[model samples]
Target: MNYEGAVYRPPSEARSLIIQVTIGCSHNKCTFCYMYKNKQFRVRKIEDIKNDLDESRIQYREVKRIFLADGDALALKTDKLKEILEYIKLIFPECERVGIYTSPQNILRKSVDDLVLLSSLGLGIAYLGLESGSDTVLENVKKGVTSSDMIEAGKKVVKAGIKLSIMVISGLGGRELWKKHAVESARILNEIKPNYIGLLTLLVEPETEMFKQIQAGEFQLLKAKEVLLETKELLNRLTVDGCTFRSNHASNYLNLAGELNEDKERLLKQIDDALSWKFGTKDEMYRRL
Candidate 1:
């Protein structure tokens, strides 16, 4: 595939065929993000994307899932997205599901009707990052969305019959607002009750603004114990059911996975073990973003 720069997707989408529909993230101003810093944001030409799809059809046999990458593929207009999805259905008849990175702004810009139309066209899931549910933390990191915005966007995806996979950063609020971050995030997730919740711990890159803040003592990094404490609070407040939850990301200190409510106690106990030094935590040398 003709990729412009670094491509990222949900870990669950590891085996899917990745197609770069957009060059970079539409809003790359988030202080914690460094993924698209080297690339400019732009949607590729319809014909060029089609060409890549055509080439992939010949190179790969029996492709089942496709993930649209290069940051927020859902930014494309409904008509344009419909055209690309239609072509995918035409060429990859066996493709069971399609997924994409989505931003709250993009999700809200498109009407419910637009989202439903795409869902009917085989767009199976969308990944949204709700780094922190605290409005102060959101504005601090420049995520460009409030907790309300996150809830609205998440509900829209669920309403459209599209699976919503949300990412929540464990220590985005750091020491200053850790409790608020944990409880408020759980409240937002409880409201939306997304299909999946992928928990990630905060780790700053030197190139990003967050790194500067840390150096200046403006923000704090939660230690392993504090992270577990925050996570425990978050999980404790979560009352959602049937949603898949995973915290085994490379940046995380703990590894956790299970269905919500059903395995809530088990997950909390695992965190307690880690906090109490009974269970192991990932070493800093091996932990990464």
Candidate 2:
């Protein structure tokens, strides 16, 4: 496959065959992200993508799942996306599902009918980064969209019958706006009620703007204990009916996984145990970007 710099996908797509449909994130200005900093944003040529699919057919016997990479594959026009999906169905007849990372901008750009068409073409899932739902936090991080915009984008995806997986950063707002981050994030999730929710702890990467801010003391990263407290508060306010929640990323101090509403109490107790030192937390040395 012709992969570009630092392709990223949701953890659940670990087993899927990854193809680079786009070169980098369309909105790569998020202060906290450096994943696609080395590359310029552009869609891969259709012929090149088709060639990769052909090559994959020769390599794998039966590809069950495919994940389009790098960030913002859905930003491509609907006609182009439909062509790719149609070609995938032809080439990988055994493929059961296809997924991609989508930005709120892309979601809003595409009409609901466009999203529904993509879903019907076997575009099974979309991973969205809701970093923090507080407008203050979002502006601080340069997320490029408001909380209401993200909620609307998510709602459209869910309405289109696409499985939506939304992710939020644990310590995004830091100490200054942590409370607002937690509550507003919970409110957005409650409104979207995505199929899956992922919580990844904030870890600033060197050379990123966020790292510079932290060094200057403009931002205050939450301590491990504080992250637990923030998470507890967020979970307490979360009211999604059947969302599956996960916080098992390497960056997270504590690993948590459960279904919402039913498992809310159990998940909260786990956080409480961690906060009280009754459970173990991941060591700082082992954490990664």
Candidate closest to the true structure, highest lDDT = 1
The local distance difference test score of model 1 is: 0.92
Number of clashes found in candidate 1? 0
| Candidate 2 structure quality by residue, lDDT tens digits, 1-289 | 6576777888999999999989999999999898998989999999999999999999999999999998889999999999999999998999999999999999999999999999999999999999998999999899999999999999999999999999999999999999999999999999999999999999899969999999999999988888889999999999998889999997888889999989999999987776666433446423421
Kindly report which residue stretches of model 1 are placed more than 4 angstroms away from their true locations once superposed.
278-289
Give each model's clash number. Answer: 0, 0
lDDT of 1 by residue, 1-289 (tens): 6677778989999999999999899999999999999988999999999999999999999999999987899999899999999999999999999999999999999999999999999999999999988999999999999999999999999999999999999999999999999999999999999999999999899999999999999999987788889999999999999999999998888899999889999999988776666434446423431
Question: Could you give me the TM-score of model 2 versus the true structure?
Answer: 0.96
